[model samples]
Each structure stands twice: as C-alpha cells, then as structure tokens.
Target: MWTAIAGGIQYIIDMGASVMLPIFVAILSIIVGVKPGKAIRSGLILGVGFVGLSLIVNLMNDQLGPAAEAMSQRFGLSLSIVDIGWPGMSPITWASELAIIAIPLAIAINVVMLLTKLTRVVNIDIWNIWHMAFTGVMAYAVTGNIWIGVLGTAVHAVIAYKLGDLMAPMMVDYYELDGLTVPHGTSSYLAPVAAVVDFIIDKIPGLNKIDFNADTLQEKVGVLGEPVVIGFILGAAIGFLGGYAPDQALPLGINMSAVMVLMPKVVKCIMDGLMPLSERAKKIMNEKFSGESFYIGMDPAILLGDSQVVTAGLIFIPITLLIAVLVPGNRVLPFADLATIGFFIAGAVAVHKGNLFRTLISGILIMTLTIWIANQTVDWVTAIGVTTGSIQAGSVIAALDQGGCPISYVFTQLFTMQNVTGLVVIGVLYAICMVFYVNLSKKRAAALEAEDDEE
Candidate 1:
C-alpha cells in the first residue's frame, strides 16, 4: 500500500510542471469558492502561460547552452564537471525515493506552521517541493539515515516558508505582486546574501547613492537604451564572444530581443489568471483568521518578467564566467544556468529596489557563493544523477540551483561531519545574513502596512 501511494505521487510529479501546476491551481481555486467554470478557465490560462514560459526558456537554453559551451572552450576555463541546472536536476530529484513523500511532508509542515502562527505563508507551489525533497535526499545519501533526511526536508521547508513571509512586503512594494510571495528555489535560500550586501552598502556614503537600471539607460540614450535594443546588443556580443561570426550572432541577437519582448506578455496571462484566485483566497483567509494577512507562496519565475531582471541576467552571462575563473578551486563551468540567471538575482533586485548597481554587487556575491557550493556538491549530485540514470556512470554533475543550496549543504555536513570548519564558517555567515534579512523584511512589512493605513 505504501509503495503504491508513493508511486502514484511520483506519477503525478512526472507529468511536468506545465500540467501539474495547472491542476493544482484549479483545485485550489475551487476550494477557495471560485465557480468551477471560472476556476477551470483560470487554470487553463495559467497552463498557457507556463507553456509560453517553457517555450521561451527552451529557446534560451537551446541558443545559449552551446554558445556558453563554446565560450568556455574558447577561454580554456578549465572547469571540468558539468553544472546541469534545474532542467536536469528536477528529473533527478523526482526520481529519488524521498520525492514521493516529500510533497505531503512539506504540505504537512506548512499546515502546522500556519496553525501554530509560526509562518503566514500558504505555500501552494507544489511543483517546487522538489527543492525540499532534494535537500532531504542529499542528506539521506550522505549519512545513510532516512530519519536525518526527513529532518533535513522539514528544516528546509520551514526556512523556505519563513523566507516567503519575509520577502512578501518587498514583493508587493517593488514588484507590485500583491498577495503573492516566492518561497521556492535559490531565490529564497540565496536572498540573505542580498540582504547582507544591502546592509553593508547602507553603511557606505557615495556607493549607497549609486543607482541604475534599464529605465535609467533608456533615459540617457532614448530608443537605443530600450530593452529590445539592449537585449539585441547583449545577445550579439555574447554570441561574438562565443566565437560566432556576425552572420550567426545577429539571429541569436534577434531571438534574445524577442525573449525580452515576449516574457512579460506571457506573465500578464499568469497574473490575469491569478488575480481572481488571489482576491478570493485573501477574502476567505481574512474572514477565517480574523483579518490576518496571508501570502500565497509561488515560484520565482514571476519576477523574471521585470525588465531589470532580464537586463541583469544578460549582463551576468559574462560576469558569472569571469567570476568562475577568479574563484579559487571552482570547477563547475557556468553553462546551463547562464540562460536563466535572472532567477538567482530576481529577489536581490527587489531588495535593492531595482538599483542595478547594487544588484550587480550582490549578484557577484550570490553567484560566487553558488559556484563555490556547487563545486563542493559535485560528488553528491553525481551520485543521485547516476542512480536516476540521468547521467552515465562516473559522470560528475552539479547545479547552481538546489544542488548548490546552502540549506542542503549545511544540514548534510552537520550530520556527515565532513568539513567541520567549512560548515562552521558558512553556518555562521548564513545565520548572520538571516538576522539582517529578518530585520530588513520587518521594516519593509511595517512600511507597507503604514501605506495601507494611509490608503
């Protein structure tokens, strides 16, 4: 019976996010009192949005993946092990034995936290439960203890929900995404690096005053500074650096420009579907909980539609490679993740209020830290990949997403006792960043509330 249950859950997960999320959204909407017809319509719109996003992301992956590989080869980056990114990591995660139970386990934890008032985030982003599952399976792999693995999943979920709570106000104020919060993926785990960077920048005088974004560039150069033009130029430059001639580079440039133009249009579809559900959920929760506010946890992809995020993602293509070369003992070449590097820095852009200069500084720290951690986790990730047959025997793989997540790394090391000093350093540093992040988030939340009062 247990085996059958697990298998059933695995089958649902195997259906892919584009299908899985739509079903989840439709069900959740119906539960919140939306009419079945409207709920189904909303779900289909979300599905359409996901399909659009998939097309753009696949286009990005197809064009940039080879270009990135060529750039690494041209520069002799000497980085050996491949970083598979989420596309590869997701399948490996869902194939794990722990993944079957992780969805229910994470949901249970979220329920407990909500009831106990430990967190205000209603994390319905079921597809991203894989992040928590990845951490658990890694810990289980390292220590050979199923209990410890479960504990790791619990801990990661708790932190992820709290991260959702903390970032909610900023999500509303900056991204204008009211009633939603991102509590999944590297965006949640790595946001503390941005918080810490924001704190330090505040201490400096002239540096703190620096601000730039796509709008600033547009103001300076008129049409030439626009996102489409900027995307084309950056894309063509990347292709040229990847050793492509002008003839080939120009088409890549045009496609990237299309990506810039099209991403937000699809996101609008998602928002249109979500708005009614969000309003209904808010109304129901407020009535049930005596006017308490709650945020619906979601994936970080929503933030990718912002122009600043797209521009930063483009700039980081080269900057991340440069950082990879500079970081000592880094072996995982930045390839697969180069396409959607925006996800990593999306929250930082919000925390910095879209100041591109500050985002660049924090992004440097975030990617460098991510690369270092991915370098550390290659063996563990490769073990899972081989077990899932996602890669051949003796293949080494890592990812800048969950594979490099510090929550998994720190939790696993705590049990395995393999690099006590590294654990202590990262553990303490991350703890400090959490302190700053909590304080920063509280201020933002309070400010948001005050604005609400005025309105």
Candidate 2:
C-alpha cells in the first residue's frame, strides 16, 4: 500500500516534468520556424490530452483499479476507479524521518568540506547545482525513505552552490564566461606556469602565514559590493604604514579604490535593474547576453580559445569527487568524471596539450555529454513499465492475489543479473551516444575542409 502511494506521487511529478519539457523545447524551437506562443499552446494541449489524462488514467486502471476491484469482491464494499484515486498506503513514517536528519548533517558536511579545501579550485555555477538537488529529490522518490531524499537533496544543493561555487572568487569569471570549462588559447599553455606559481606560494614560510583563504570569490564580491569592506581593508593597510607617514595626511587613495572595485556590481544591481525600463534595455541585454552563449562568456574579445579543458577540469574535480565518492563509493574516479575526459586524454597523449584545437574539441564534446545527461535525467520517471500474459483467469488469479514480486522488479532482473539494471542501461546508452557524436563531428569537419579548399 505504501509502495503504491509513493510510486503514484513520484509518477505524477515525473509526468508533470515531462509535460513541461515540450514547452521549454518549443520556446527554444521558436528560433527554428515555429511561432513561440502557438507552439507552446499546441504543445500544452497535446500534453494534457495524451499524457495528463490518457496515460495516467490507463496506468491507474492497470495498477490500482484491478487491486481495488479485487478488494471490493472480497470485503463486499463496492468502490469505483474515481472513488479510489490512487492505490497505495501513504508513507507517513518515511517522510517523518527525512526532516530530522537532512538539514544539520548536510550543513556539517558542507562546512567540513570548506575548511578542508575540497572545493577550493572549483568554479561553482547554477548547472552544477541543479544536479545535486535533482539527485536528492530522485533518491527519495526512488528509495521511499524521506530522510535519504532530504539528505541527498539539501546537502547536495547547499555545499554545491555555497562552498563549491559561492565562496570561490574564480566562480565569477568561470560562471560568467566558462563555468566548468577547460583553458584554451595561449592561456592553455600557461597552466603549467600557474601550477608552478601556486606551488611556490605554498612553500613561502612567512608568506604562508597569511592563510590564503581560497575565499577569493566571496572576498572579491564583498570588497567589490558596497565599498565599505574595501575601505576597511584599505584603512588597515594605511595604518600598517603608520611609521612612514607619522602625522601628515597619509589619507592615501582609499575611497577611490573602494568605488572602482564596486563599480561593476553596483551597475549590475542598480543600473542593470533600472535599464530594463530604460529606452536602451532591449539593446543592452541582447547585445550583452544573447550574442554569445552563457559558457562562452561576456565578450569574444577576451575569449581565450583554449581554456575550456582547464576550467572544466577544475570544476569537474568537485562534481567527480561527489558523484564517484558518494554514489558508488569509488573515490578514485578521475578524468573519466568529465564526460569527454577519456577522449581528450587519448587525443592529448596521441599528440600533446600543444594540440590546442583538438583539446578544445574534446572539451566541447565532454560538456555536451554533461548537458545531455542533465536533460535526460531532469524529468521525473513515474510509470514502472510492465507486461503480462495472463493464464486462465480462474487458475492464475490466486497467484497474483497473494503478495508477490513486482513485475517491474522481475523486468529489472531479466536485464541485469545484478542490482540496479536501470542505471547500468543508462550508462551504456550514454557511451554509445558519445561515440556516435564524435564520429559525426569528424565527418562534418572533413566535409567542411574539402569544400573550403575547392572554394
């Protein structure tokens, strides 16, 4: 009974998400010949007609309707399909336990990760975040254990956004331009240079005393936000130089520094907000944001062609660490964490990082895979598909009437000899898709080059 209710609710959520997918896809599809409003309305109508009503009603008929009818015959209380909306006992006990455990424990784990420098170098962003929350929600829906779901969702979301993305200064640059990207162009060659500098900084005896809180993301924003934080930092610096100044006005460029640092955020919050109403709003927004994609960054002027791999690798560390360690309990998952990491390494080893173009292609390939996985998994999955061939109704009814293995569970086993065959199937499908994409890209490149030579 509890299983029925949990499955029904989760199924509704999944169906709703699926219903919304067409709307989102249609909105994007407006660029390709469809009228946005018309496409949206049509999609919504079809979703309602086919999925919202028909699919669900049929599913309910197959599952709960049969069970309810059987119970009616036994107990002698007649109930219609409409009277019993969904079959299954409410999981009251399951939800009660989730709330108690998730909040405090997730917070504690996030704090620990922060102090230990686990996500220090990673760039945090919105996309990285959506995964953890989604994971948490799915985990609960699947397990029917509220605590597991709560813990998975809340912990995954907070640490990912806060310690991982928010506190880190590099996130601003990476997210605005290249969230979870690799380094490209001449900058690609400079990774080794930066690595050496970071190593030297770590070794500095007195310099090291100043705990370089890889807290640059927050500090940068704070010092740049209102000018007050920067003023305080600057005022402290001036006081440190008291011996040189003594009594003369060593007032020293404090306010000016504060304003300059804060100029961008101030504009973003105030001017940009107001600009939407200004005569130039559309032009400014489109010019700034629409011309290039989100990962591509602010303006092409600063787009170093080869940075995607390094940026991706840095951010990939957190994602990889969390996914592999927490999910499968395998702490050793590395480049494979990046959807395209293995392919890039194969190509790089074949040539070198000096092959910047190939590296960039590899980086794009990986990011695409990440996007695909997110898209596929973002929707809720409710219907546990099943099939049956009944024997003579009188003979076989009793076997099904008693408690037995769910047909879905049997289907699960037939596919995989081990547990969670669903996850294994998904992994295999993704690998096949990646190979197909890579081959297609190689073909397109060859075709384009041949045409260019002829012209």
Candidate 3:
C-alpha cells in the first residue's frame, strides 16, 4: 500500500503542471490575440526546442547516463527527451512536446478567441508554408543516411504548419483564429517548383541575392524538357530503395558526404578560389567588403502561390546528376536518390506558372542557402563539442539512432577508413570543379547584369 501510494504520488508529480494546462492555455489565448508569436507553437520550432533542451539538460546531467528521460519529469511533466536528427529533438521528439503545448494552448486560445470575437477559425499557420516545405525537402534530401528523420521532419512541418487549418473545428489553430491566411497543405505538391528555384539559385551563386521572385514555379514545372524528361526516367528507376549515401557492393566504405555534398562544394570552392572578379567572391589581396547582396530577390512570399512541382523537378535532375556522378558507385542505379530523383521527375512534369527568369535564378538561391545552413550546422555541432570525429567511430549505439536506418545500426561498418579514402579521392575532383565553376559564374554574372540592363 505504501509503495502504491508513493507510485501514485510520483505519477501526480510527473503529470506536473499539465493539470494547469487549461489555465495556462486560457491565459496564452487571451494574450495571443494581441501578440502573433504567442499563438504559434509549431513542430519545426519544437524540433529545435527539444533538441536544444535535451542537449543542455543532458549535458547538465553529464549526458544523462545514455540519453535523458527525466528532464521533463523534473517539471512534473512526462517528457521523453531524445536525440533529434540534428542537435535537437526531431519530429517525434517535437511531436511529444507539441502534444503537451499545442492542445492546451489551443483550448486556452480558442476559448478566449471565440469569446472575444477575434476569429472564426479558417487557417492555422501565420505565413511561409513554402519556406517550411522547401527547407523540409532540402534537409530531407541532404540528410544522407538518416532518411526516416528527414521524412518525419517533412510530416511534422506540414502538419504543424496547417494543424489548426485542417482540424479547425477542434483546434484553435490559425484557421480557427483567422490569423493564419497563407497556403494550406498543398505545399508538398509545389515542391518541384521550389526545387527548380533551388537549383537555379545554386547554378548562379549571387543571382539569388537579387531574385527570390519564384512566381514562375508552376510555369517552370510545366515545361517538359530534356532535363526533366531524362531526370524523370532516371528517378523513377531509382525509387526509394537507397538512401543519401548507400554503401556499394565493393568493400570500400563510400563516404557519400565527400561525393554527395562535400565534393561539389569543394569543386565550387576551388572555382571560387580561381574566379576572376566578384566584389564579394573575389577580392584583390586586401579590400573592404560588405556582405549585402548586389541585389535582393523579390520576396519569396509572392513566388510561392504561383509555383508548381514540375519546374522544381527539372531543376532537380542535372544538379542531382552532378552529385550522383561524384558518388556513382555507392548505389548508382538512380534508385538511391529518391528525393532528388523524385524531385527531377516531378519537376519535369510540372508546368511553369510565371516567368523564365524565376526558374533560371533558382540555382543561385540553392547555393546561398546551402552555405548558410552548412555553416549553421557546423556552429551548432561546435557549440556542443561534438564533431564528425566524435560520432564517426563506426560503432553502432542503438540509443543514439532513433530510427532504424540499416547503416546506422553498424556505424563502424559504414564509417570506416572508407570515409578517409573517399574524401581524398573526391577532394581532388572537387578541386577541379571549383576552378571551372568560379570563372564561369563570374563571367556569367557580368554578362547577365548587362543583359538585364539592356532589357
């Protein structure tokens, strides 16, 4: 009886402030009417929140004896803290957190909003569905071996972005409050167009700085051309059988990172090193500089409504091919790069909805965003003292891997000396591309600006 009593007492405490959740929701709901952010508790945001909390608290408790499980309990709330794909809680982790926050917040806010005549519940997200979706796709595509987490991010972002919009009757989400008036769940369908924008931006480095107007996303998708035609055939053949970097039939450990992501960056970097003249990309020995773009792309907001999936796919293929060749033997048949292949295939089939330049300029955007995201990832890892080496021992820790990616199960088998060998090989290849790309980009930029001026 005494034991039962203690157990029950612990349960009560573990429930923590959940009992007061309604009151908390009520208070927040009242305040959210006046403050926008106070009303939005999304999954993407939670992904960062959970992971950050887990890391800090786990570190606070010295790694929490193999993944912390009681951090939320301290608050009398049941929290299942774990490693997200990145440094924070992932979709699953955020799901648990969102359940705790969203429902209560919804009830509180909904009740208040209804009473105050603030809204009628039509949408959920405040804005930027395209940004959420594009980032989701990009992150998922580049996650390499951690595909499940990538998918989870996709699902969570989509759901969280429109949670209130879809379940308006029950949720005090954006739709219910009428505060969210962006797009709905159709963002994924438009991913192909977004993909096109990404590819275009990447091709022409700084071009993205001046052109975020992706209004032609749909129109870009509509044009069924060689790039998309070939890309679709190739992507369909690839399917979802392989991941970002699958181990090849050979004994060699293929460091897909080297070829898949790093190789291209290296080549581009080398080209950057050799490029002729760009005020920012190149400087004559010692020169003052400002990070501002030569121009800013139109707001991405205007572009999202008009884009489609086909154009995004067309842009996806060739770029995918570049990375594909670098990592060819690892899982070559194209089935391995489903996200990328899917992108190309879908993009080819999509219809262009706006202008040609919108599609053309996407490549530059991809390059810029990739650089920012890569740097941010590095900064996050550095902050936690966890580097590629710390986690690269090729030993599988089930606890460390939330999802069951086969390669993840055998770390050493996957991350062996092969990583070192592949890096060396690709490093040489990237150096070559770098030299070429840098010069081409510079000349192209000058010519394009002149052309634009003439137009």
Candidate 4:
C-alpha cells in the first residue's frame, strides 16, 4: 500500500510543475470555497501562466547560459564544478525517496503552525515544496539517517513560512502584491542579508540618500531608460563580452527585450488566477477569526516581473560570474542560474524599496555567499545527482539555489560536524541577519498599519 501511494505521488510530481501546480491549485480552491467551474478555470489559467513562464525562462537559459559560459572561458575563470542550477537540481530532489513524503510533511507542518498561530502563511505553492525536500535530502546524505532528514525538512518548512510572514509587508508595499507573500525558494531565505545591509546603509550619511531605482533611470535617461532598451543593451553587451558576433549578440538583445515585455503579461495571468482565491481566502479567514489576516505564500517568480527586478537580473548575469571568480577557492561557475538571477535578489530589491544601487550592493554579497556555500556542498549535491542519475557516476555538479541555501547548509552541518568552523561562521551570521530582518518587518508592518489608520 505504501509503495503504491508513494509511486502515485511520485508520478504526479514527475508531470512537472506546469501541470502539477494547476491540479493542486484547482483542488485547493474548491476546498477553500471557490466554485468548481471557477476553480477549474483558475487552475487552467495558472497552469498556462506557469507554462508561459517556463518557456520564457527556458529561452533565457538557452540563450544566456551559453553566453555566460563563453564569457567565463574568455576570462579564464577556471571554476571546475558546474552549477546545474534549480532546473537541474529540482529533478534530482524529486527523484529522492524523501521527496515523496516532503510534500505531505511540509503541508502538515504548515497546518500545525497555522492552527497554533505560529505562522499566518498558507503556502499553496505546492510545487516549491521541493526546496524543503532538497534540505531533507542533503541532511540524509550527510547523516545517512532518514528520520533526521525528515526533521530537517520540517525545520526548513517552518522557517520558510515564517520568512513568508517576515517579508509580507515589504511585498505589499514594494510589489503592491496585496495579501500575497513569497515563502518559497532562495528569494526569501537570502533576503535577511539585505535587511541587515539596508540597516547599516541607513546609518550611513551619504549612502542613506542613494536611491537609484529603475524609475529614476527612466526619468533621467528618457528612451534609453526603458527596461526593454536596458535589457537589449545589457544582453548585447554580455553576448559581446562572451565573444559572440554581432549577429548572435543582437538577437540575444532582442530576446531579452521580449522577456522584459512579456514577463508582466504572463505574470498577470497568474495573478488573475490567484486573486479570486486570495480574496476568498482572506474573506474566509477574517470571518472565521474576527479581523485576523493571513497571507498566501507563493513562488518568487511572481516577483520577477517588476521592471526593477528584470533590469537587475540582466545586470547581475555578468556580475555574478565576476563574484564567482573573486570568492576564494570557489569552484562552481555561475551558469544555469545566471539566466534568472533576479530570484536571488527579488526580496532584497523589495526590502530596499526597488533601489537598484542597494540591490547591487546586497546582490553582490548574496552571490558571493551563495558561491562560497555552493563550493562547500558540491560533493553532497554531486552525490545526490549521481544517485538519481541526473548526472554520471563521477560528474561533479552543484546548484546555487538550494545547494547554497543557508538553512540546508546549517542543518546538515549540525549533524555531520564535518565543517565546524563553517557552521559557526554561517550560523552566527545568519542568526544576526534574522534579528535585523524581523525588526525591519515589524517596522514596516507598523508603518502600513498607521497608513491604514490614516486612510
């Protein structure tokens, strides 16, 4: 019976996020009081949006991934281990035994937290549960204990939901994404570092006044300030730097410009599907709990449609590679993940209020730290890759997304004790960042409440 059940769940996951997410969403919507017809329509729309997003992301990876590799080669950045990135890493995660139980485990944890008032986030982005599963898989790899791995998965899920709560105010204010929060993936986990950086910058005199966002550039430069134009320029520039001829470079520019334009339209489709459900959820929650509010946790991809995020992602493609070279003894070259670097810093951009200048500062730190962690975890990631046949027996692969995740790294290290010094340093720094992050969120929530009162 258990084998049959596990096989059934694995089958559904194997269908990929574009299909799995919609089916889950449609069912969840009906459970949450949406009409059946509307629920089905909503699910289909969300699926279409995800399919559109996948196509755009694939276009980005197909075009930009090679350009990044070429640029790395041109510069003799002899980073040996390849970062297969989330697209590759996610499949390896699903192939694990831990994955079959992770979805249900994470959902159960969310329910327990919600019932106990420990968290206010309802994470319906079931596809992203893989991130939590990846954590468990890493712990299992380190200790060879399945139960310990399950604990790691549960701990990660708990932190993820709380992260959703911590960033909700900023998401509402900056992205204008009301009642929606991102609890999924690297975006939320690495965001605390930005909060810490933002706090220090706030204390600095001249730095505190720096506000160079996408809108500011648009206002100053007229036509050239537009996101599409900026995307074209950055794309072509990266291609040229990568040693591409004018013909290929110019087409890369056009493709990036298309991404800048099409991202929001497809994201709007996702929002169209989400809003009815979000609104209904809010209504139900308020009525049941007497004015209490909650957030629907979602994927960070939704945050990437903003012009600031799109422009920042383009700028970081080359910047991330440079950082990879600078990090001491770093072996993982920033490839597959470079195409969508925005996911790494979308929360930072929101926390910094769309200030590109601040995002650049924090983004550098984020990538540098991610690379350092990715370097440490290459063996474990590579092992998992091999076990799942995602890679050959001896192939060394890493991913910056979950491979470099702090929670995963810290948790696994606690059990292994293989790198005690690393554990101490990262554990302490991440703890400090969390403190600042929580304080920042509280202040933002208070400010928003005050504005509501004023209205």
In candidate 1, which residue ranges exceed 4 Å CA deviation?
A: none
Could you tell me how far off, in angstroms, the CA of residue 330 lies in candidate 1 after the best superposition? Answer: 1.2
Per model, state how many residue pairs clash.
0, 26, 63, 0
1-455: candidate 4 lDDT, tens digit per residue: 99999898888889998889889888988999999999999999998999999999999999999999999999999998889899999989999888889999999999999989999998999889999999998888767899998999999999999999998999888999889999989899999999999999999999999899778888999989988898899999999999999999999999999999999998998888887688889899888877888999998989988999999999999999999999999989989899989999999999999999999999999998899999999998987777666778877888999999989999999988889999999999999999999999999999999999999
| Local distance difference test, candidate 3 | 0.28
Candidate 3 lDDT over 1-455, as tens digits, reads 85575554334323322222222332333343423333223222322332333332232233211111221222232212122322221222222211222222333453454345443322222222222222222233234333433433344343332322222211111012111222222222222233334444557876645532233322465543333233333233222112212222111112111122222233232222211112222232122223222111111111211123223422443343333234323212111121222222221122112233454333333322222222223322222222222333332211111121111111221222334543344344334433433343344346545866999
TM-score against truth, every candidate = 0.98, 0.24, 0.26, 0.99
Q: Give the per-residue lDDT of model 2 (tens digit) for 280-380.
A: 22233236545421221111112222223222222232233233223322212222122222212222211222233333333343333332232222111
Candidate number with greatest lDDT: 4
Selected candidate, larger lDDT, 3 vs 4: 4
Sort all candidates by TM-score, best to worst. Answer: 4, 1, 3, 2
- Which 10-residue span in candidate 2 carries the lowest summed lDDT? 396-405
lDDT of 2 at 11: 44
